[model samples]
Every structure is written in structure tokens, then in C-alpha cells.
Target: MTHRGAEPPDGTGFLAVRCDVTDSRQVDRAFEEAEAAHGPVTVLIANAGVTHDRLLPLMREEDFTSVVDTNLTGAFRVARRAARGMLRVGHGRIVLVSSTAALHGAAGQSNYAAAKAGLVGLARSLTREFGPRDITCNVVAPGLTDTDMARALTPEQQSELLRRTPAGRAAHPDEVAEAVAFLAGAGYVRGAVIPVDGGAGLGH
Candidate 1:
């Protein structure tokens, strides 16, 4: 599902359903459409997020709430819906996409960091609640991925961050996706936060 209803490239066998994570009805409808076209959803990757960077003092209430609503609450909305189908099947996998900012706070990203950090707690709680039924939930925290978000950063900002990273480079998107794929297939790995940050968050 995507907010803009974007389709995968031809031959990918993906269905592009328009759904906004912020709306419960949209979440439900997307699942219904997916299930109708394919089957019950057994794996969910909650990756919807938006960033509104600002210092705490300069951030408005809306700024903080909007980020949280999309990043944290949005994951919650979709996960709740997906859990229904997983419960019926008695097994499933959930992977939450978090970020390194969650572990090592950024100077002007309190809202984004808080929301991403919340994902860890959410994954842990879901693991406990669903473990007995063979449902596993985990988080993958990626740092400075080579995505549009990273590209949006100024060159100097990117250079500064890479200098701090042990690898001195941003991660390929595939690297992060590989971690998610691993978690989805591993039955025993529950409530684990696997870092795919090129050692950027090694201590954390």
C-alpha cells in the first residue's frame, strides 16, 4: 500500500493499493483489497514515516504530533489491522522499520527520534502478546540510508554524518531490506532490534 497509489514496475506482481496509514478505514480497506487479490496477510512491514525536524523549543505542537501520528501511530494502526488476520492464521511476521536516530539522538529530530524509539517498545510488546501464537515482531534500525531522505540533506550535513559513521558511507536500501527479509523468515527471532547501520549505532 502507498499513499500515492504508486505501482511497482511491470512484472513485479505487486498490487498498488492506495491507503493512508493515518486513517483506520484506509488501512482496513487496503488489507481487504490485498487479501482479496492474494491471500491473508501473514507478513507486515510497517515502514510509513514522515519527518518534521525542529529544535524542541522551536517545534510547534502540530509539528511533533504530526510526525508521531504518521511514524508511530501509523504503524500501530496498520499492525492492529494485520494482527487480526495473523491471529486467525495462528502465525505471522511483523517488521518495523526504525532508524539510528532512535538510538543516537539527532540535534533537531526529537520528534522523529521519539517516534522511531517507540517502535522498539511496540515491537517488544507485540512479540510478547503474539509469541504464543507463533507471530514474531522485530525492528530494523537503519542509519543514513541512500534514499531520497538522505539526498535531501545538505552535502555538508551528509559529510558530517558519514565522518561519524565507521563505514563512512550511507547504507544501500537493499541492505536494510535484507534485514527485514531475514526477520520475516526467522521464527525464533522475536522482539529483536537488528541494526543495519554499518556500525553507526554500534554502542546502542
Candidate 2:
């Protein structure tokens, strides 16, 4: 696990530590450091995910399994660790960052879609388990966004996607972040899948 940023000044109230979510040891250590610096963790954003897109037939077993392990199981790892402190504190927020692909599906992204779809179940389950403790678990699913990942699409692919999107464009990363922020403050919002897509996956 490696991070490339310096810590904030003493009173800036922020810390970004290197954490490999797929590795439980690293996850635990990251939280330990956070708890020591701050107080008990009251909010958790399980947003670590990766994608390895390949047609189902040509996709290697490792590709499929690794995507699931990191995207789905990794969210589980971080949330589980955070929940311990949240439960003791008796209040918390857990927002899982998912994708529109999980709702509408995408060709050559079976593994990614599957892993993201799993987050919905994970969030809902956690809500049921932790609601009594005042811990809300929810999912924020974003569609194609104007990020480096979107910039990699071929011209034709990009054009087709934009044409299909109801908003006639990809989303801005800040739009998705805004949705996550809303959920963070919404203590009553639990087990919900909030779509940050520009109506791309509207029906679902």
C-alpha cells in the first residue's frame, strides 16, 4: 500500500493514509491510525473499486475473481472494520459507491457490473443489521463520468454513450460526489440506491 500525498497541517483536520482494501491487514491498520488521530469513526464511505472489462467468453477467471474480490469484498472489508467503532458509538453512516453499470448492465463489463451490483445487497443488508443502532447504509450509483476513465473511450463509443444518455452528456465527478455528500448527512436515508447518473439508467 502506497500513498503519494503529505498529511495535512496539524489543525487542518484531514488525513489520507495508504490502504489496500483487498488486504484486511492494511484496512485494519488504516482505521487504527484514523481512530488514534480522530475520535471514533462515525461515518464511512466504502468507495474503493476497480474494473477489468472483458467480454464474458474471453475473460480470464482471475480477471473476474479479482474484480469481485476488490470491488465487492473490499467494500465489505472496510465497512466491517468501520462498523465496529460505529456500533460502539451507536450512530454512523456507510455509503457505498456503486455504478450505473450495476443497474443497467454493460457489455464487456460483466465482472465489474456483478461486483457493483453486489454492493446494493451489501448496503441493504447492513441497513437491516445496523438500523436499530442508528447506522444508515446506502448506495450511490454513478453513470459514465467525465474522468480519466471516460476519456479512454473510443470516439465512436463516446458518441454512442452520449446519444443514449438522457442528459445528452456524461456526468461530472462533482455531481456524483454531491450525491454521496447528501447521503452522508441524511440520517433517515437507509438501504437506498441513489442514482447519480444523468438518467442513463433511469428506469432501474
Candidate 3:
């Protein structure tokens, strides 16, 4: 589900419904609408995320909770909802879009890091729970992607990250999407954490 109305440029076989992942009702309704339009959902990508950057010492309780609620708990809501249809069909793919911060913690991002880290646990646990049913769960951890979120980072932050990255540049959004697409089709690659971070998360 997206937060804004979206339509395919080609305008065929696509419906974009605005739904908030943090709300269970919205999550259910979104799935209902999708299923109504195109039948039961066989693939789910839990990609909703938000950041509230602050050092642990300076972070407010809400900062931590809100990030976790949206990034981690929101994933849970959608994954759980999608599992129902997958269970009936006995086949599915769930890909969670995590971050390199989840593997190598970023300074001033304790909340975002923790929330993303939780996704690994959730995906692995779901892998075990759903494997017997022919369902797979995986995570894609991307770093410094060329997206609005990455652009929002200060130039200094971007420079520091690029300096650390062996490839010396940010990833294209399509690079991350490629990994997600691979996971969706690879039935044997369950509970894996694929990093599309241009080696920025190497050795972590």
C-alpha cells in the first residue's frame, strides 16, 4: 500500500490504493481491494519505512516508538495479513526492505537501525513458520540509494557514506528493486539477507 495515489504510466492492470501500514484496518482494506482487483496476493513487499534520526541520549520516547511502529510493526501488520491468503494458496513470497544500518548501525540513527534490525528477525522467523507451506520470506538491505529519502540526508552525510562505499556512489532505485524481484521468484532462497549497498555494508 502507498501513502499517495499512484497509477501505472501505462495504465493497465495496476491499481494503487492509498493505505497506511501502521493501521490494521487500513492494511486489511488495502489487501481486500487488491484481491478484489486481481485475486489473492501471492507476493508481498513490506517496504514502508520512516526515519527519526537522533542519538540515543537525545532521542525522545516517541522518536523511538514511532519509527519502530512504522518500520517494524507496520511490516508485521502487512506480512500477517498477506500470510492468510498465502496459507490458503500454499505459495507466496514476502520481501522486507531493510537497510544497511540494520547490519552496520549508523550514528544518529538508533531508532531506524533498531527498527530495521527487527525486520531481519521477523523475516527469519516467518521463514521458519511459512517454509512448510511453500512460502518464502527474505530481506533486502540497501544503503545510500538514490531516492527522496537518500536525498533528504545532508550533503555531508551523503559524502561520508559515499566515501565509505567501495563503489563510491549511491545505488539506483532499480538496483534494489532487482534484488526484491529476484527474491520474489527464488523459492529456495528463503530467510536470506541480500545487501544491495555497493559494498558499503561489507564485513558487517
Over all chains combined, what TM-score does candidate 3 have?
Answer: 0.95
Candidate 1 lDDT over residue span 103-180, tens digit each: 898878999999999999999999988857889999999989998888887798788789888988999999999999
* TM-score of model 1 (CA atoms): 0.95
Count: clashes, candidate 1: 0
Output the better candidate (1/3) by lDDT: 3
Clashing pairs in 2: none
Error of 3 at 14 (Å): 1.5
lDDT of 3 at 128: 90
Give per-residue lDDT, candidate 3, residue 39.
83
User: Which whole-number lDDT from 0 to 100 does residue 145 have in model 2?
Assistant: 85
Q: What is the C-alpha lDDT of each candidate?
A: 0.89, 0.86, 0.91
Q: TM-scores across all candidates?
A: 0.95, 0.92, 0.95
Write one digit per residue (lDDT tens) for candidate 2, span 1-204: 123233434654467677888899988888888888887778888877778888988999999999999889999998999899998989899999998889888888899999999999999999999856789999999888898777876788678777778998899989988999999889888999999878877556
Model 3: weakest 10-residue lDDT segment is: 4-13
Least well predicted 10-residue stretch by lDDT in candidate 2: 1-10
